[model samples]
Target: MDNTTTEDTSDTEEEILVYAEFADSVNIEKYNSMHILGIDTKTPIVQMNETFFTGTYENPLGTYMFFENDTSPQSTDPVFDRIPEKNVKYVCKTRKLLKVEHGYITPKDGSGQSTQNQAQQAQEDAIKMVSFKTVQEALDKFKQEWCTNESSSTDNNINNLKES
Candidate 1:
């Protein structure tokens, strides 16, 4: 029956996909990307095939070489020694390679960034502790005391009143 055939075909396709995934997992350790190998630093990334490049991989020399296990995410490591040359390869300039030499790419949060965040939090805490008796009184006092500069007119008036 047609229904029976359809179910069998669907089950077969599912099994094929699972088998392919399992096969890829087995070879995962051997696979590495041209980018993770630091090939992008020295060489440009390109796709040569006019056909759809569903999955692609290359060595340092621009050769078309597919890894046995390419299911893993791209690598973060920064070096590669082998690349193959391909006929359809195209080349273009790339961004400056980030110097990852001195452990520049790291997991540590920046001390300065965190320091500023803490300082801001402390400032907010200090502001919350201020218990002004009244807004108008606070504002009047703030205006009189905010400027450290001496007022010559006020000084002269104070002297006149003192002499009187």
Candidate 2:
């Protein structure tokens, strides 16, 4: 008899207990705070008598309201009654997104080709290719050259090499 009574009381207590928070997301980082909305603290709800707060803990304002995690506030829910909080996690502050504009694919018009392309044809034109051997020779020529300043001096060292 006592076991049956305990089960009935436990069921009623579970139904009434509601836990919530001002959450940025319902992810692993849900502990992070968001805007706070304080419930009607001045006049408690006649039945529940629970003070529910909305918004962040720092800034508790009643401008907005909150509902349970699973219960979403819908157009169908009647007034002076309970509604659900389905999208509690969905709202990001990167929140209340009005619209998302995505970049559209450009038409394959002749004017709209890659800048590197010689023509707007489907394929790119082949470029002139230089051989590695030719490039190395050019580099060697530059490295071997002695870049002397064109100093205006008329000094002649050993006018001509004699057969000493």
**TM-score against truth, every candidate:** 0.21, 0.16
Name the regions of candidate 2 deviating beyond 4 angstroms: 1-99, 111-140, 143-164
In the range 27-66, model 1's lDDT, one tens digit per residue, is 3345343132322234223222221112222223223222
Best by lDDT: 1
What are the per-model numbers of colliding residue pairs?
11, 12
Model 2 CA lDDT for position 128: 44
Candidate 1: what lDDT? 0.39
For 13-62, candidate 2 gives per-residue lDDT tens digits of 32222223323333324334433222223212211122222322223232
